[model samples]
Target chain A: MAGRTARSERAAGTGEVLLAVAERLFAEHGVFAVSNRQISEAAGQGNNAAVGYHFGTKTDLLRAIVRRHAERIEALREEMLERTGDSASVRDWVAVLVRPGTQHLAELGSPTWYARFGAQLMTDPVLRELMVDETFGPTIRRTLEGLNRCLPELPLPVRLERADMARNLMVHMLAERERALAEGAHTARTSWHAYATGLIDALTGLWLAPVTTDG
Target chain B: MAGRTARSERAAGTGEVLLAVAERLFAEHGVFAVSNRQISEAAGQGNNAAVGYHFGTKTDLLRAIVRRHAERIEALREEMLERTGDSASVRDWVAVLVRPGTQHLAELGSPTWYARFGAQLMTDPVLRELMVDETFGPTIRRTLEGLNRCLPELPLPVRLERADMARNLMVHMLAERERALAEGAHTARTSWHAYATGLIDALTGLWLAPVTTDG
Candidate 1:
């Protein structure tokens, strides 16, 4: 039993190191451009097939990276949802939607790779479906339902369109902020908290904005 | 002289074909993942080095693709600006901001690649500078000035933040719509013109949204 535990722990450690290395490399190089072999080599594995051995395939490796971040983000949102309850205002619900991401990034501190990596997945057709399946499951669905419950009067199509807009804005803007933070460049908002505040405010307006033209 | 003119025209024709092929491939595949050799070969050039011979670098090729569209977008916005000429309504200025790209995309008809291609460039760090320099030059500056003139009372930081949000929403949303069209999937708005109208409405609300927390 002791020997088995030791071997399992070592395997877990290797997985963690591979995930970290893969995330950083994917954030630096384009996801499709970086091979499984390169990620394994970067993780200091003597066996080039280490990634295959550990993660199965490149897509599986990408999912592992996303799942790592999504798990934390979901937990953050779940806690926020507890605080919010059914009485949540539009801004509160938007906070539920946006804060998990910014907060997670803030908690991760500098040189984080999740935002850039997530943004790329959000753009890729196959990878986006994988990410949405992983991240936008139970917790996100509940949050959106809560938000929609509050937005009872908005037209369905308009609501859907703005939701799409909000998601895009949230993902892409945070990606930009992350990139800026990594590069030590100037950002208009000083901190992640401030950035989320700005986003929630604008999104509040966006979600509540009157629909003029009907689709 | 006639033979030289014919040769130049033939070369220009090849360059145009290469640009079209490159844009489509870059849109379908991530920009960095697609090679100039692949682009040349995809364009049916016998020499795989044709991309290099025609365009000095990958960035140069990307720029050439952007320049091809920028000229058309610039002309469209110039016409719209002539009609707007310091209109104080936020929506009018927002229209000036949103219309040109969507209108250009609409004019390009179904399965256009520029939006997706441009969105990738917008997200990329090094290429974003090229996109802004090439596309965000004088006309955008003037439009922003006019938009600011309309909202003299809005806080500078809020204005800047909303501007960033608007740009992100515009680029990414158009990219999504473009992708959906390419895939023959459902989209909220049926036409690009309507899409711009929806964007302008949402942006008007976003820009005029009361600043909740002062930066």
Candidate 2:
């Protein structure tokens, strides 16, 4: 048991190093522009096949990075769900979804390459399809289901439309925020939290307006 | 003078043919995936250098296609402005923005490829940056300025946020509608127009909700 634990720790350490190095390279150049050998070398592994041995392929390595970030996001979703419970309002759900993403952006050592990679992936047919199926689609399905249960009075189509609007706002803001950062803007002072809150307020108002009228 | 007019007509005919062929090729296989030779042959032109003579390079060809579509969109915007005149409601503006895009989707010869090209363009940094600077940026700036003049009650930050939401919703809907079409969904049954109207109603509701509260 002791031996297995030590080996697991070593493997995890190696994986962490590889992810850190690959994230930087992929951000600076691009997924297509970078090579596994370069990633191995940068990770300080003398073995050229280190990437394959650990992650199977360059594509797999890219998936791992996305998955790592996604896992963090998923955890936040769960936390938000638990905190808000069954009676959570539309405003509460919006805050839950938006806050974690902005907080992730604010954190130190969060990959600067993710925004560029995400933008590039948006155009990549295979990657986009895979991500839609694997990452975003499932998350969206689950989130919408939860939202629907909470907002039963709202029509499905309307809920879907609002959800789409919220998502687009989030992605657009993230992309713009990244561009601002690249252009040497001080993101620390940007007040993304307030911006997010304002967006939630706007969307919530829209969602509940009809109900208010009926009442 | 008669001879000059005839010559210009001939030039326009060939230009249209080249554009038609270029759109088909670039849509089926991405811009990088398709070649100038393929475009020439597809257009029934014998000369491989025809694309270069007409548009300079592959990137230039893409820019031309984008510009062509953008012009139509600009015309729609102008028509909407003229029809709505000085007292255009938020719903009027939203309808003007959303309706033309759906109409463009419906009218295109190969909507699938056009959509793929659009999705690619949205995420692509180089293409996105260029398109924004040359095409979308001017239109959006003009629209925002117009909106600010008309809807002075809304704060600048709020106006910008709403504008961002509207643009994102359009992009997401276009991409989703295209995907549905690519998967062999019938246009009439899909009811994208209905979807657009729903979005417009929801967004207008959101934007106007605050104003009502303030009043």
Candidate 3:
């Protein structure tokens, strides 16, 4: 029994290492550029098929990496939503939307790769649906509901469009800042918290922008 | 002399075909997923080294593709800037920033690949610099200058941050719409013109959003 438990623990450790290596490689190089064999090799596995053994497929591996970060991010969002319960302020709900990812990145410290990985996933045609399905949940839907309640009169199409624009802005901007910091380049905001504030402000305004009738 | 002229014309024709094929493949598959040999074969070149022989390297081929579209986009921007001379209204300057790309896309008709290609380029770390250096030109600088002049009160950092946010919004939003159209998915706006109007409204608000000092 003890031997079996140790073997399972070893397997779990190998899975964790593969996830980390895959995230960093996918972040630095394009996702399609890196192979599962490459990831297994980089993770120091004796077998070249370690990634395949631990994870069923490349998509499954990618999904695992996303799930690792997303679980924590969603928890943060849930806490923020609880605190922001029944608030009428768009900025408050916007904070609920933007702060979780930035705050999670902040807690993870510098040289993080999840943001960059997410940017690539969202940009890739086939991979984007996986990202959407994994990331958006009831918490996000509730955040949108709270935000929409704050603005009762916005056209449904406009709301949907702004939601997409806001998501793009948040994901890519976070990735941009993460890439800059990793490369030792200049960043506009001093910290992730301040960056979240900037995003929340701009996205708040984006949601409130008046819709034009004529093209 | 006549044979040499005919050879050069055929070379130019192959280059155009290579560019078109590369863009579409990169859009459909991830950029790094598609190889130069694949691009050459797809373009029906007799030799597999055709991409290397014609464009020198993948980066050079990418730049060539960007240049092909950017020249037309820049010309459109020039015409818009000429008509929008010295505009103080933020929306007018925003229109200058947004219209050129949308107008160019409209001219390309359905199933356009440039927006998706541009989105991938902007998201990739090594390739983003190429996209920015190719796309942001004298006209963009002049538009920003006019925009800054019209809003003299915004802090420089806030202005820069908002500019990045607006850019992320426009690039990814356009890519999203183009992807939807390519996949026969539903789109929020009816036409490229209306899409531009929607973007212009949101980006204008993004620029005009009030900055928060306390973070």
TM-score (chain A only) for the predictions, listed in order: 0.91, 0.72, 0.93
i-RMS, every candidate? Answer: 2.0, 5.6, 1.0
| Candidate 1 Cα RMSD after full superposition onto the native fold (Å) | 4.8
DockQ of the candidate models in sequence:
0.50, 0.30, 0.71
- Best-performing candidate as measured by TM-score: 3
Clashing pairs in 2: none
Least accurate 10 contiguous residues by lDDT in model 2 chain A: A206-215
Per prediction, fnat is 0.47, 0.34, 0.73
lDDT string for model 3 (A175-202, tens) is 9899989999888788999999999889
C-alpha TM-scores of all predictions = 0.91, 0.78, 0.93
Cα lDDT for residue A9, candidate 2:
45
Give stretches of model 3 more than 4 Å off.
A1-12, B1-12
For chain B alone, what TM-score does every candidate structure achieve against the true structure?
A: 0.92, 0.74, 0.93
lDDT of 2 by residue, A25-101 (tens): 76556555579999898777889889999999766887887777776777766676667767776667666767766
lDDT of 1 by residue, B1-215 (tens): 97796576477798887898999999988787789999988877899999999899999999999998999988998998888864458888988899999989988878899999888888765677898788876777788888999888988978887888888999889998898899988877889989888888888888877777636
Model 2, which residues run further than 4 Å from truth?
A1-18, A25-53, A108-111, A137-142, A186-192, A205-215, B1-18, B21-50, B109-112, B137-139, B186-189, B209-215
The predictions' CA RMSDs to the true structure, in order, are 4.8, 6.8, 4.6
Docking class of 3: medium
Compare the candidates by lDDT and give the number of the best one. 3
Best DockQ among the predictions, by candidate number: 3
